[model samples]
Target chain A: MQFNKAMILSIGNELLIGKVLNTNAHWLSGELTKMGFIVDSIVIVKDDVSEIASAFLSAIERKVQLVISTGGLGPTFDDKTVEGLARAFSLPLVLNAEALALVREKYSSRGLPLTPERIKMAYLPLGSKPLDNPAGTAPGVYLKYRGVHFFVLPGPPREVEAVFKTSVQPIIEREFQRIDFYEALLTIKGIPESEFAPFVKDAAERYKSVYVKSHPKGVELGSPVLEIHLITFGIENMSQLRSCFEYILMSAKKLGGEIIVLKEPGVKL
Target chain B: MQFNKAMILSIGNELLIGKVLNTNAHWLSGELTKMGFIVDSIVIVKDDVSEIASAFLSAIERKVQLVISTGGLGPTFDDKTVEGLARAFSLPLVLNAEALALVREKYSSRGLPLTPERIKMAYLPLGSKPLDNPAGTAPGVYLKYRGVHFFVLPGPPREVEAVFKTSVQPIIEREFQRIDFYEALLTIKGIPESEFAPFVKDAAERYKSVYVKSHPKGVELGSPVLEIHLITFGIENMSQLRSCFEYILMSAKKLGGEIIVLKEPGVKL
Candidate 1:
């Protein structure tokens, strides 16, 4: 039951309109990459019910074992992800007793009246396991259907992070075997890509699994900058990978280009 | 011909690994939205040639009238976006004289040696138009085939922004009719979403064209915040849209809630 591939669905129009920054996707991607999971793709759709349903179908078609959706879980007109999910899977929407109890307690703790609208948060797709959200009122929903795991988390970054760390990560770890992974980054500045190609080519030819990428940084002051990155990953032991990365760095230094920054694991920037 | 839809393809693995932030996509989305163009989606893929080609085909299949890809125009093993674009369109890669001249001048201006690898920046898809990149060596590529317009931009934020403003924006504007749109945001705190549902329903019912969306924000201490946004478009005039938005804001205020913040055009925060 190991989940090798995942798809992220971020539901929000604010992101499309640039009203809010999308830090949730970046944080989730980084966390999953560190855990040795391959994120296939990320899709950002509006809060429309049809769009959510269509995105879900597409993720399933892509064969992503785990589909994580963030947003559209609140008690508002546009918060329809739960309804969409249920409709997509042909499951019924019912009020869960545990979720209702959590909602009531959450409102009571704040000395606020448990209004009819607040009760809406208790509704969940049939057969979903509710994960407690201590940071927010909206509890995360986890559903498994036809061998695919779908997680619905609240939109807020803090709430999403808290729920993922406490509930989702544990399940993922338990289900998937541990794999060794390592990554290295070398940031070069003020070097043309052509002048740096020979060194990069030599490194790539030496290491079969290593990948070198050049990002053309726009001109600064009067000179252009190109950030050359060397990335390597494998499922076996990481010592050889670390050694290969070190050798690449040493070669890059010998090439005599302006190296602005270098960052790696167990090393501070 | 009016280009109403566009898809952005960001080429880099640094984005996936969290080594670099993707500010280009955000900036491009905002700029396109302001110009009355709907950005259907954004896909960030690795610099792998096959992946880039597959993504290009997918974007075309999605029926987006315009496709803009950023990155992979440099002279390295990973800089394969241009080649991928050529292969995707079944066109041969040819060195454009204007593009070569631009590269030479850029290197000579900076007192840098122009190596053979640097000439790779001049190679582009056949029959493509070269757009000037004053800030970098990689000139933007513009190609129109089978009614799809493709614009290839350098990855650097500064160069991309400069080239887009100076060269691409005018061409796009000339080819499309601008539409009028407006959005309003109201940040309310100290109230759960359930308590605010009825108010949103009433407002939506009153304004047929106004779309109401609620984003649950978990940033502020003590009480969770919900950002209620009202977006309206397809109006004949901008002033009418502004007046309509003002009335909606007034209605939201009458519902009796804690309004944390409100922002409007020509008004400072």
Candidate 2:
């Protein structure tokens, strides 16, 4: 079974300067992973046009099936995401009629005039459709280039969530089949990572479908706490994922690991 | 004076899978920005050798002065960061004596034998120096290649912080002269982002050294709250940074914006 690959680009100067935490990338990664796309990379770039363009081109070169970029879709001058996307594909930036109507309706409802600053949000790359932003003035953009479907979203967390759920999610659902992605976390103590490392290695080699990773949460020599996360993509069923997880737990038991918290598969933490 | 450019690579499957939130990227971006480096991009890739090599090559192609990668330096099979770096530069991975000694001492202190999994952490790319991990077993790797300084750190947040503070920070201080980077945040209400955007654009143009960005916090038509962040790099003194910030405040006041909060430069939020 072939899995669709996806990439996320988070564009903003606030993100680059560390003034804003990139919760958008994390949120989108979760959404896409649940939808069955293997999120290959999450890149955070500044609001500079060249940087944004280069990032987009790199994603294109990687041949990802889906690309979702959040941020830089505002009215301000620093909102250069669309311009950068246009430059990446050598396409012209045009005033999208649907986007302009959305922007006009949003402002008119608030009894505000369409100033040049407001109209700036209407400009999009050529041959792109506008995704209606239910929460903001700047309409999200949707374009397809070189077989890669791109969804360009706004910077604000509320707006990103709204646009992705309302506009982007449906398209993803229609375009790809959801793979059975199941995972469980085992918070185990009393075994150092160095000693447990062999178990993880052997388990990874044994279970072809499962990916096991050990995150050291506490000191190795003193009170060692390791969060062993087991994940399986494209599993036949939950039982298969569970069996793989159970094997890892049994191995942990051999080394006197006390399981503090066992977050089972399909259970939200 | 030209600002040095830097890039951050956060490599791990956990990050790409959204199992982990990348606070390291944010923290390092803040630290690098405070040290006068222009953080161009932060790229998070999965723990794949080719993906890691490609990310590193892109950073080099951009001519960044410094590059720091966090994660994938461990005693497991998936810890392929050092191997990836070697592949990027066509350099051979060799067991460094210094790194071996450090790893041996770390393990032996706990009365643990030198297993192959434990010994795996000592392999380093040729000519790279090992930065002792004060908080973990895997020693951080430091290499200068083609005019770009690279620091490869481990995954855990505490280890990343400890290694950076003890090993990376001193080298940066000695290599680069500090440049003045001062910033202030002004939280104002009653002015919508579209209405306030023109002033931000003008301020950005007038104060060439200062970067002005506005983040919308509240509804536009309702009680609009916006966070206007003003940043000035290479300023002569704090007074100049203050003057630039004050000018932005004056513009905000002209629009009848009520000042809700003013986070002064050098004040931690």
Candidate 3:
């Protein structure tokens, strides 16, 4: 069977405008892949409620086992991702008491009165828990709808990471099957991608169980370096994975290519 | 009139898997914003033909004037982005003579026989012009369907950027109304984001044309730094833009927060 697949939804207008780099999408995907989840797509939508709701519904309809969203969980008028989730699932937006406490305490600890706008952060779709967000005022969200778990985190990189590690990770471990992830890389130098394509295609056709992909490091035709990346999922034995890696490495050397770097068990490229 | 809007589609499974950072989306959006286009969304999909075709059609249905896609332009099995575009528009995938010339030249210069796989790069959707790709073998493609222009470029960043500058930028300049893009950032230190929210929502309500966003820099509630970002498009003059900028700056100062960094007329954050 294939690996458990997930999807990422990054909600904001800033992302579309390029005001912020989507380090969250990149970071979360890497973590999820390491945790044995196949991230299928990362979709970014505008701040409008309709767009946000549509994106959420589409992910669920696609039946991705896990859906993680970062951003649009703020105290501004534009932060409507939760309300969008509420609309998507036909659940009433209600103040989660536990979430309210976390948010309220964050402000009270700083000796600041929680304004109406600030208190708005406590409202979430019914049947959802407020994830502890030690990093900011807006508490993260955790909910499961139709067997799909959705982890909603804050916008900032630091805030997202903190909430994810402390609140969301444990839930994922309990709910999903964790498989060992492995990757293999062959950094080939002095080959244009055209010539390199035949090798990849052959490997892909030959090794049905392994992924064979090429990443051209430099764009120039005579570039010195390119990356041949391979990954296998749900394989029980490390030796089987290593054999898959060796088969490709040996084939690359047959092309008269110089192998600059090799990660025995593929490290994240 | 509304601001010129654009969308980005990064076609590849590598992007979704976090194997590759979508620096292209960020870089393209920033450049488009600088050229005065309101980038609406960045959608990343797998290399599957149906997904790629569907993503392209969805962007067009959203009425974005310019849709730029990167990736899946190589000669491997997964490189099916062009075939996807052809399916989306119901165009025949035929080899254009000019594209053939470019592909033939690239291989001929190296005294290599153009294999069938190499020749596959020449076949593109009918009625498309091959954009010059000086950096890679697969020539970029440009086509207009139903009043939308699609620029399909290679996966590598340098190749995407190079072809964009040489072939795509001129078309964007000619077809779209380019406005003067300006941004103003007021980096406030020592404020909780809860304390910072009302200011942004109020400014967003007041400045109808400007986008006001607040980013919590540090994780602590009482952290010493926060950033308020503002952007506007199609302002007639710098004074008009400056006036919009002043409204937010003055309000932040009134809150007794220290303005640590001010990017007068915003730079890409």
Candidate 3 lDDT over B68-177, as tens digits, reads: 99999977778999999999989999988999899889878878778777789899999999998887888999999898999999988989899999999999889888
Better of 1 and 2 by lDDT: 2
Each model's DockQ?
0.47, 0.74, 0.66
Residue pairs whose backbone atoms clash in candidate 1: A117-B194
Please, what are the lDDT tens digits per residue for candidate 2 over residues A107-215?
A: 8987999999999999889999999998877899999988899999998989999999999999988887878677888888998888888888887877777778999
What's the true lDDT of residue A20 in model 3?
85
Worst 10 residues of 1 chain B by lDDT: B260-269
Candidate 2 per-residue lDDT over residues B31-82, each given as its tens digit: 8888888999899999999989988888788889999999999888899999
For candidate 1, the share of real interface contacts preserved is 0.44
Q: Candidate 2, which CAPRI tier? A: medium
Candidates in descending lDDT order: 2, 3, 1
Off by over 4 Å in 3: A236-240, A266-269, B237-240, B266-269
Q: Against the true structure, what is each candidate's TM-score? A: 0.88, 0.96, 0.95
Docking class of 3: medium
Residue B235, candidate 2: Cα error in Å is 3.5
* iRMSD, per candidate, in listed order: 2.9, 1.0, 1.7
Q: Write the per-residue lDDT of candidate 1 for residues B23-130, one digit (tens) a residue.
A: 787888788777766777777777778878877887778798878888887777678898888888789999899888888887787677667678888888999988
> Which run of 10 residues does model 3 chain A get worst, by summed lDDT?
A260-269
In candidate 3, residue B226 scores what lDDT?
A: 71
